[model samples]
Target: MAPPRNSAVKSARPVLAPLSIGNATPSNGGTPFRKPILTKAQRKAAPASGGIRRYQKSTELLIPKESFKRVVTSTVSDASKAHPMRIGKEALESLQEAAENRLVKTFEAAQLLAIHAKRQEIQQEDMKMIRRYQKSTELLIPAAPFERVVRELAQDLMSDILFTKDALKAIHVEAEDVLVKIFEKAQAFAIHAKRVTITDKDIQLAVKEILQ
Candidate 1:
């Protein structure tokens, strides 16, 4: 005998139903909230971006398998916290070193007189435009090294730039004044030592050796 005549018609396959927010029964034993009171216009407008008919056709979420794995991993890690990615000690040390280097560079940049007021030193290597960079952080000159340097350089911008012979002479003059005072004290010591031939050469050599 032939198959039943209606066998030509396709069998209706089971499909997952779209969730209904308004018509849903509460799963937590709480009484379901009454259906929303939507206006005719609102009812006609779709709550789902796609039609219910289209969503019914596809039960799979529109996400990649890799993306789903990432989502599941994050959620599981958050909930159970079973698997944790540990950063190695070496990696941590490297990161710390890199951070220190950057901080050093930043401090160095801040010490430039032109940039120090703004706490950013412009470097020719960086070729960063001075106009483009705005002063953000406090540009503090490094205290001991810069206190005397900035005070003396106020008279000349070039003093802050190139180390010219005149700039070195200015530094030498300052040093000479300090040395003169030191020499007077040394002379008093020298009298006690019974040495008068100990001239400025001895003083100069003594100063050089001591400083070195």
Candidate 2:
């Protein structure tokens, strides 16, 4: 005699085995995973995977060579002469490099001053104070004579632009102030390097330290 339909249907259903927790394998494969550990040196050398990265110094030149050369030519050129003074390629490069170094050093000193004051940004006051400090310690040059020279340099550099007496006077003051700051930084660089004389190389090194 045939079984009842309900009984047959119940019998046709397959039974599932109970899962073994201890011997269970991952769906990906039977292989167990382990993280690779790094050594102290390796860990130290590795870059951070997350969060803000530290600032890195750049090796590239900041100033444009053509513009620097134009300014240099204007400063050194004789107005009485018909033709402008010629600069050798090597001489131009050296001048540009030196100028860049001095500028970099000045910025570094200003930045340090800002940092010391718990400030994130450098201010004009910081620069002015630096100049004031330098001026206090150094022997004073006659302001009238120096300002006259500065006025001539400014006129030569920008012959097309007409400057008022007040503008020229401001320019003279600014130029003198900046030069004082730059000299202070250069002297600090020399002293830090344990040398009595401030060399072009010291200024170059100072720039490298800031931007390398």
TM-score of each: 0.18, 0.36
TM-score of 2: 0.36
Candidate 1 has its poorest 10 consecutive residues by lDDT at: 131-140
Per-residue CA lDDT of model 2 for 5-103, tens digit only, reads: 787798789976444345544643444444688999788657563521232245555677888878888777856366656889899898887888877
Candidate 2: residue pairs that collide: none
Name the regions of candidate 2 deviating beyond 4 angstroms.
Answer: 1-60, 78-84, 133-212
Error of 1 at 198 (Å): 1.9
**Clash counts for all predictions:** 1, 0
